[model samples]
Target: MVSGTGPETVPEAEFRSYYGHPVIKRPIWHVPHMPLYLYLGGLSGASSLTAVLAGLTGRHRLARAARITAALGASTGSAFLIAELGRPARFLNMLRVFKPTSPMSVGSWILAAQGGLSAAAAVSDVTGILPAVGDAAALATVVTGPLTATYTAVLVADTAVPAWHAGYRELPFLFAGSALASAGAAGMLATPRAEAGPARAVALLGAAVETAAATLLEQRLGLVGEPYRQGRAGLLLRVARALTAGGGLLTLLAGRSRVATAASGLALTAGALCTRFGVLEAGRASAADPKYTVVPQRERVETAGPASVPGR
Candidate 1:
């Protein structure tokens, strides 16, 4: 409290935490592994959705490419996740009980189901076996695919990290857009240019959505969003935005050119990866800074008034 002649004349308290330490512990999720998992999980989820849609529309080559991408992404992503857990059993242990209220639990289940279904679809596509079962599996992924793409956003948003928690409204859309862009990139890369028109369209749409969501998140978050606009996180996100924008334009003008398609696909893939890494870095930065945690809380208390404050 400020020393003043009267209460009304006192200045507001400056924000501080004990001994300059962070008010909340920084997330222990390791670099590369966690971000890679996030990217690959989104890729797998969106690829599955693309595969199902392409198949329904008679784009067999595109569908096959998406199926393969979905299977590989899911399997590889799960490996990264298991490695992060330090044990495969730890990954399996999460499936012992279903908890609807737990985003991690729900995400684990979605990942498992998506992985299995995508793998089945890919195998059937490659081997020309179990066509009926493959169709069923591919169709089932429609239910799990969108959930898998966006659930990680929920998982992170549930945490206390100001960057993640405060942007909950926009994070899911951001992740979903990134996921779609990733899958579309994979489809474009794997399928022939002539057969990849829909993939290009998806990539363009995803880029638009991703860019809009990211802009809104930063704008709406105000001070809490500083981490995303400064430091390593800012650099990465800027690169992501540039790459995604360039890739989207390339896809728009690709015009049956294999080189342009490949270039756009590669750019989009890199942008999506950068987005995941940047988001993680922003969350870490926010968690490490005391101001991000304290300012909003103080503002909330002040807005609610002394009568509503706890322990008053």
Candidate 2:
């Protein structure tokens, strides 16, 4: 019999990267600008949708408020984006070509289109010069608005960032819901409580969707999702959830009191902004950490076995 040492246990491998550097480069997008653009883009998109719905339902006051909000959000968001790019021409340059495969290209086009449409709608509403043209512009936004709101999710997810790529499925839903909540809040704040019933309903629905999507994203991502639960990202997200949930509940009671409507609107707006910031922070954290990148690649290699790995 061979003198035998029973099979020895293998030591678990510790994650490391070349010189402790991150495997992937961190995002170049700046703070406040990127997150704020995200919030405003979503707000513009959802507000446009809300405006159309309100107009169709004959809620002129609510529709007018939403239209103005959408225009302002788009214009302001574009300015932030331009600032991030460091030149006004860079913003215009993006519109020079449209690439179907590129999220950035598509998003740029959508932003431009949405901005123009919303602005026209707002101007027409305010000036009362061309009702037909304004109505057409507002109707046009229904197509571009949702695209504007959700395209940023696609943009980030297309990157190699583990947390963002992993949560791709949920990100759109989260963004969409946040957008709706933002627009609803804006509508409620700008319009009287009596005319804000639809806005309240939209806010509640949006809050529910946002909360559910965020929960599912954290639960489904396993290790990749850790960034969202740890550090600054985690803190912001937690606050976002609390404020959004609280604001949603308050929206239920807003019908009876103007104070309640204002409170709910403000809370939901703040919550939506927090969510955008939290998501951006999570992406940065995940990209900065080598473990998030290495572990997932290692897991895939192990699952495929040494024989199946490339160059084996």
Q: Estimate, for each residue in 1-312, the C-alpha lDDT of model 2 and write its tens digit.
A: 233766667788877678988899999999989999999999999999999989988899999999999999999999999999999999888889999999999999999999999999999999998999999999999999999999999999999999999999999999999999999999999988777777887888899999999999999999999999999999999999999999999998665788988898999999999999999999999999899998898899999886756785
| Model 1 regions more than 4 Å off | 1-15, 308-312
Tens-digit lDDT string for candidate 1 (67-180): 999999999999999999999999999999989999999999999999999999999999999999998999999998898899999999999999999999999999999999
Q: Give the Cα RMSD of candidate 2.
A: 3.1
TM-scores, in order shown?
0.94, 0.94
Pairs clashing in candidate 2? none
| C-alpha lDDT score of every prediction, in listed order | 0.93, 0.94
lDDT of 2: 0.94
For candidate 1, the lDDT comes to 0.93
lDDT of 1 at 272: 99
Least well predicted 10-residue stretch by lDDT in candidate 1? 1-10
lDDT, model 1, position 28:
99
